[model samples]
Target: MTQQKIRWLVVLMSLALIGLVIFQVVGVRETLNAKEDQFDGSVTEALDAVAHKLEKTEVAVLTSRRLAAERRKEKLQQIAIHDRPAKTEPKGRKASPRKADPATIQRYASHSPIVQQWEFYGRVTVPSDVLNRTNGTLTDAEMHYVEEYYRNESPPLNPDNRLRSELEKTYDETMFRNLRKDVESVKARRDSVGKFLANRVVGDRKAAPVRKHMPKEAAAKPKVTFSRPRVSRIDSARLPHRHMTEFEKAEQKSRVMREVLLDMFTNDRPLNQRVDMAILDSLLKNEMSIRGISIPFEYGLRSDDNPHDFIFTSSPGYREDRLLDGYSMQLFPSDLMATDNMLYVYFPERQSYLAQQVWTTLVSSVILILVMASCFYVAMSTIVRQKKLSDMKNDFINNMTHEFKTPVSTISLATQMLSDEAVAASPSMLNRYLGIIRDENQRLGSQVEKVLQAARFDRGEVRMMRDQVDLHELIETVVHSLSPQVEARNGVMHTNLGAKQSIVTGDEVHLTNLIFNLLDNAIKYSGEVTDVSVSTASSADGVRVTISDKGIGMTKENLRHIFEQFYRVPTGNVHDVKGFGLGLSYVKKIVEEHKGTIRVDSAPGKGSTFEVWLPF
Candidate 1:
């Protein structure tokens, strides 16, 4: 395509690429936003689950404490008992049995017959063996003291009294110790459950392994069967006064147990305490993991009343004010089921996280842009190079046609003169015409030979017949041969063959042609009074030959491409110097074949220097 069209195409392509990039960037941004949103959603879900678990764990702990208290109460009740004081029999004959208290009978008369009968029967069937089986374990005085203490019919037992010791011996102080142990066990269970739930919240499988903690002996224990408590009915007349039926006693115990359970559920003390920092940290890490955020973080709790004070933090290095400097998330107390507190979590590597999420898209886009730019650059370079070569080729063809046409036209003119009868009659004129024809033929042959030689060198078909050659002798011969051309141009040629060791191994014919090409170029491009210099010098590794001319020198731009095939210095409408532009190219190829280096130095308004270094 034409240059204008190519430029337009490039512009259009660049605009299209820019548009595509913009569109893709927008799309990638949106996709990244969506991914970020998904991550945020996942984090929120994980945090919610942790909050729920924490709340549940707190409730469990309160319930365990309440249960422990109830157990202790039951143990205390089991160790103490109340009994009615025994009535004394009369000394006189057949003392009449004591009548039931009048107030007790009146109270029983207020209820239904069945209820009254039950109460009365319980009183009648009351155990009479109080302290009877433990005769050796406790003295009568100790027994009476214990019974009186439970019945509230005497002063309370003193820890220092002998009665207290006797009571402890009979009652087994181990029961109180057992009650303490049960409380401790309950506390341990609560702690273990709390830790387990915390571990679950953090996804720590190693924290509490179920199989590792379970005792093998537990599997060997026999299952115990449980039966419902049985209720008994009694006749009121057969029961003693101020007694409770078995059903009533069991009902009262059940009511106390229910109260304890209700208190357990209603307790809110656990929420007042500060949340466990380790558990909070674990929970944050778990949420981060679920959201695929692998970054270092710190967290702190802020109370609503004192927002500046952090009640708890993972580390002292954690700064609450700088929390918003990075990626931060907040959890309010309302969301966590705790006192008015806020949890703030900060991630230090927020940018890194974002980059990680979009690196693929960014890298791919950059690569694509670079590839496109590179392709465009290469294409433009190739086109420019091809255009330059085309122009040079046209110049070569025109110069070649002119060069050929000159010789052919001269030969034709000579032949036409020889064909004239008048010219044939004149012997000198005929001889002169014959000489002209021969010279033109020789010139034509030399041009054709030069072209053929260049082609052979290009195709690697010019085999060198290596032989010992004298460089000084070769330079002298070429200078002498070209001296006539220099004189014809009104120019002077100087040769300074200064090399002492000028003998080298090379093909003599090619070397001769190489020198001839250089000398010819120097003479051809010189001014009307051209002053050319040819010099030679010996070096440690090679021979150096230099050809210089005081002609219209070439610009630096032209010198750069001077030796390229078909390249010529621009001489604005001046066709005075004529050639196919092949002389320097051929010289360069022959010099290289002989393992030599060639270089040129020139500047506008100043002369040029062509230096050839050939190895010995």
Candidate 2:
């Protein structure tokens, strides 16, 4: 694609990504708001429930007290009756209680706690015994009811027949449970008093398991009859009241009592006294948990006029953060807008809780945005790099064409002159033309080799030699070869071999070429009198070879791409410096392959210095 097209594409893609990020952020914000709204609704519901629970609790307490007082009054009346003196009967007759009729006795027996329970439970066996007790007022046939009552009473083995109707059953079940609890309490007390060992011994002697052996004939015989196993008896009363038997009427009365309890349960005190901080805090925790909202909270009851004046506060934290806005509602809001107290509930981590509610969505959105951004970045970077490489390649082609064209033209011209009759007639002229051809051929071959060597290095095809190489000797050899070129240019070359250790492992040919390229660049880009300095010195775990030139140096910008392949410094309309711009680049590769480093120091108008450090 063209540069303009690539730039527009990048711009458009960037805008799209930004828009996508904005939409995702908005979506996450909306989700958080929704979660917060739900949380608020739940909190309000829980608070209302807590208020109702408090009211119900108060009603139950008052009702229990009222019931206890009535029971005490009944007990007082019973005590007075038992302590009262017997009435004077006929001024001299022995005082005697009136005997109750059979009908009255039966009526008393219907209540759960029957009249004279001990004597009633011990019903008289014979008529004479009842006659003696009643002062001969009852006859034998008339006392049939007493005998019939004993006969009709269900035994311990069969209680279902005696406790007829649901009401009686319900009361009987309750009494049975209480009796079991009382027995357990007695056993617990006996064990607590260190009577466990004594009880265990007495129990073993009194209730030891005994197995009676039966005769073989008896065991083989068929069963004659079936008898129910004996069962423990439960204390029960037969309620004769019609209201107790009529369930619907009884339920209606219970409802009326509940309404009275509810009215008494409501708190009527002033808001300040009504809201106990300790009780409110406990209620808040419990109700919030019931609603499944478990988070740290702060609550305070401030005045309606001045919010700063707190009637009650759950904690010091709530007081400190009172200025921060939270959920505010009226305490005792049951009175509508005229509520006296203003209650405020704050969540220190409200924002964090909202985030947690939508954590999965938030994290996924972030990851997707990052992934898209990274992909766009990689795509734009690749385009830029490819464009840069394309420009460099074009520059390289032009430089190569010019470099090759010069040598070929010279060789052609010399061959044409030698072919002429006058030029071939003299030996000097013939030799001159032949020399020109040979020199041009060598020049052309050298340029082709430079290109080929770079290509081989690019493909990693260049073979390496592991033998130790002497840097001092290698620098001298390269200098000797390039000395002729320096002399021709009216330049001077200096070598300062100062390193104690100069041997390194590398390819001999490539090392020679590496040195040749640096020296060549030093000579090519120089003033009228080229002054090149080649030196070797010992460095950290290596030998550093330095090549410097007192010539036109480069700018900082050019220095960046100085070692880049096919990259030449821009000099408008001037192709003064010639080559494929491959020398420095090739030098860098060779140095790196041998476990070495190369750095260059250069600036505009100042001299340049190339430092190559190869480990010994």
Q: Local distance difference test, per candidate?
A: 0.66, 0.70
TM-scores for all candidates: the values are 0.66, 0.68
| C-alpha lDDT of residue 341 in model 2 | 63
Worst 10 residues of 1 by lDDT: 197-206
lDDT of 1 by residue, 439-472 (tens): 9999999989978887887788999999999999
lDDT of 2 by residue, 26-119 (tens): 9988988888889999988877776666556555655666556654554555444333433322333332223335554454345424222222
- Clashes by residue pair, model 1: 117-234, 117-236, 120-239, 123-240, 124-239, 124-240
lDDT of 2 at 447: 89
- Residue 481: error of model 2 in Å? 2.3
